[model samples]
Target: MIKNANIGVVLVTFNRLEKLKKTLESYAEQTLYPQYIIVVNNASNDGTTDFLAEWENEASPYKRIVINLSHNLGGSGGYYAGEKEAIKLSASWIMVADDDAYPSADYIEGMDSFIQSYIGGRLAAVCGSVVEKGSYALWHRRFKRKGFSLEYSEVTRPEDYQKKDFEVSYISYVGPVMNKVALQEVGLVDKDFFIWNDDIEHMQRLGKYGKMFCVPRYELHHDVDSQNSALSWKSYYGLRNNLVLLKRYFPLRFLIVLSLLTAKAILCPLKGKCLQEMRLRLTAIKDGLVGNLGIHPVYKPGWSLKKSV
Candidate 1:
């Protein structure tokens, strides 16, 4: 261990018992174990509780804190809750990852060393490199500016990141180690963003506080087979949150993004997998433009977002 590194690793999970187990197993094998493992369970009806009961009871080298919520708080809310708990632990560093993010055994070691190497550097966080499980392709390792807004660089090659470290405009939630100093400086993660784009919004805000860098030397496996826009509810939240983030961080680019949304809405039906997906996108854009956010009926049967709101 790195002598009281005090790195707290937070995870937000729901209805992903098996995936969560694998992720925890990976952490258990880490060469440099985190001081704390904080997991925010988003009201999972699955056997996650029972699994965790057994898992946490096993011998471990660190503290395991599990927060079971009363209801499903979505990704953003779960992360916020977990991060808050990690912060309360007075950890010097905090690293949050999704349930499916499986890091290499040396990932924690590499990150600990990287932070130690940059004792006097202005680093907001160190985002680890993530590769798609099946394709083995690097997931947008670079964050950058697009037309009036932010965008990710194209799928990168492994050799592209041969450098020890490189600066980035944003950090993904796949796996990013953050120092308490930077966390307090940037502020808490926004809970309003119930799902997608929450990480992007937080990263944008965080970039203003300090610099972000990608450490490809640290490896991660993001078990994402594909990103099909056909998932109505997923696409809905994604676009909705994307618009909300764009407006929050890049108001000048609001119209630019809005214009693009309009185009997508108009042509989506023709190119999209089905009319349902197109409609979801349209509804997302409308709600986004009107600043409307809440639980929607599409996610639950016979229920409406208004009820939750």
Candidate 2:
């Protein structure tokens, strides 16, 4: 609806080629198309690179910029790179999404409408309602901050969210449309985070500038499992990054969180895969405390340095 609005869409992906394809199709179906679609491929070995190459070569209505990294930078690094590029393109607003997440047909249109109407330099960012599977996924919620320790509360009743836009203290990477000026002031995402909690840190930065809102009219479908099992590589990054954030924000609370994680690691089952997970958790705690970041060699997705019994 808004003419010549440079809305850049940045999508970060790794190994999820099928989901990425569906996401791209969703983008194509948008009522209001973005000026640029920037896809940051994190060196996925699962034919993702080949697929992107073909997609980029194909004819499209809008411009497609694909950046294939030599190594996997994880979500944090990937988003940093993509958003930086979006800023360089002189995008007035930037929208970010994961490969497994996509917006509804009028998603971008609604975001632009809000930007043109309600956002008169008062709002830093705006996110849409995220629906996973068939039900309302309360991935976007308010985060209560206490001495740098962050906790979020979900809406028990999804029907409570009316058509009106609500203020949010926290914003995730899923389908958030960010203003360029706010991004320039806050700077890019912390690539050092490597994975989890980067969005929270970015949300904190944006909160310094202006208020962020969640417009329920714009919907996005996120294909993600809300639960994480006990044994997972994600445990390492989540625990480590959470500790890093705690230490950076509140040093006193850091020790308290560290002690709890240490106890969990020690009390974990001592045999089989649980033992492996325990070892990884302990390593994460150490890394978080010492400010050791970047992708862990031993603890990674799909592959890990498993110890023998």
Candidate 3:
């Protein structure tokens, strides 16, 4: 069993300054502090730079480091950069976190113990449950898969995941603590997927090497504030990246799911904000048919934000 594993935390942030600060504070409060805390700023025009400067000035015993990227590399790029840094620091494990999410005080401690107990090194990744803030709406919907009756659909507590470990085709990468050795064997996140589905793709790849566990005992609050409107660019990426993920991983299954989802989006255009979602789905299909890849700005000159909503 791996003992005294040196862990590193990587947090990626964009324009959310307040949430990011809270996440950092959570990191500082960890019982077993990470050897390195790296924050990758994804070119936020907001006061993110200033806030980082102020945070740097405030003395903290933990080792805190920040890397400001000139352009917005999106979530995939930021994680890629952070992973590289963690490797350079010789970290045995890397905990990836979204700027809006923060772990419990005993998060790292629990993860370390869990790792030792189950020989986590043999697994590709270990992830925790993400508790949604405010209404708990997101959390409720996460496992609410219609048409299929999942045994663990109603699980809300850690004890719900009592099963030792199992293989999953898809696993959330929001705040997963990955095994450095497994990562080296399977490779890193797909950089082509700028945002969404990158985690799904990585999970799919990792499953080839070893198992992934959802350690529900260790939880974190994923702060997802309700937004008034959907950004056109975000819709584009969600649709486009999902298409890429489907093509790269589950081509046949994706086609079937896409067709069903598309039909649903068209029929209930207004409900669940399906109108905007339909647009993204269609556009993603078009982009895939035409063969488009790599990074592109969310907002273009002609794209109407109102039309998207």
Candidate 4:
């Protein structure tokens, strides 16, 4: 372990007890253990509480700090709470990851190594490369762009990242090790975001303070297998928060994003599930345009929009 690293790893989870268990197991394999493992339970109704209770008791290398909230705070809120706790703990570095994100044994070691070697002033964070299944996840290592445009097509091959670290525009929640100084300057994750694009918004702010880079040398396994084609409650969060981010960071590009969303909303009916998809998209557009965020009572996981609308 790097001497006086004072690293704190924060994980946000909700209703994924088994996956979280695997994540914790992965942490046990880490060569460079952090000072603390902060797991924020977003009020999961599953056996997460009991599992965490037992797991924390039998901890080995690091102190496990578990924050059990009374209600589901979503990923953004969970990170906000967990990171706040980490900041209070006076950790020099704070690493945030999803419950399903399993970092490689040498992940933290690589990050600290890079940070130590980096001559760049005011380093914001280092985003670790993420792998889905056996392939490198290109989407996780996104290109930072000015305005509302996003680019991940810069590097076609994952092998290209093997040789050198690249500065990133976007910061995914997969595995980004942040400096506490940057966190203190940027403040905590926006609880208003509740979920999607919260990282994007936070990334925009972090850029102002310091440089952010992606070090593919450090890897993490993201076990998510969710289908992108499916439009669910999360689509609402994605759409609305994206709009909010566009307006906040790229005011000039706001109308362009709005236009694209409108076009998508209009053409979404072509794919069938006409009314359901259209209504959902339109509702998202309306809420986004009006800047109405937070959990929508009508739009929730496993809950259909057809019933309410």
Q: Which ten residues in a row have the lowest lDDT in candidate 3?
A: 144-153
Expressed as tens digits, the lDDT of each residue in 1-309 for candidate 4 is 334355789999999998999999998887778788999999899999999998888937788889999998789889999988999886688999999999998887788788888998889889778889888888766665444453312442476577678887667888998889988987878987888888878877887888889888789999987676666788888888888877776776778878987888888768655777787888888888888887887786565554455
Better of 2 and 3 by TM-score: 2
Clashes of 3: 0
Model 1 pairs in collision: 295-305
In TM-score terms, candidate 3 sits at 0.78
lDDT by residue (1-309, candidate 1, tens digit) is 334355889999999888999999999888888888988888888999877777667777888888998988788889999888887886788999999989999888888888778865587888678878544445545556465663533445567578777777766788988867877888878886678777878877777777777777677888775664335456677788888877776777777888888787778657844555566778888888888875665653223333433
lDDT of 3 at 201: 67
Q: How does each model score on TM-score?
A: 0.87, 0.90, 0.78, 0.91
Sort by TM-score, best first: what order?
4, 2, 1, 3
Question: Which should have the higher TM-score, number 3 or number 4?
Answer: 4
- lDDT of each residue in 57-93, candidate 3, tens digit only: 6776556788899987778889888888877777788
What lDDT score goes with residue 43 in model 2? 93
Model 3 CA deviation exceeding 4 Å by range: 1-5, 57-59, 134-169, 227-231, 257-281, 297-304, 307-309
Evaluated at residue 273, the lDDT of candidate 3 is 58
Candidate 3: global Cα-lDDT?
0.69
Q: Pick the candidate with the highest TM-score.
A: 4
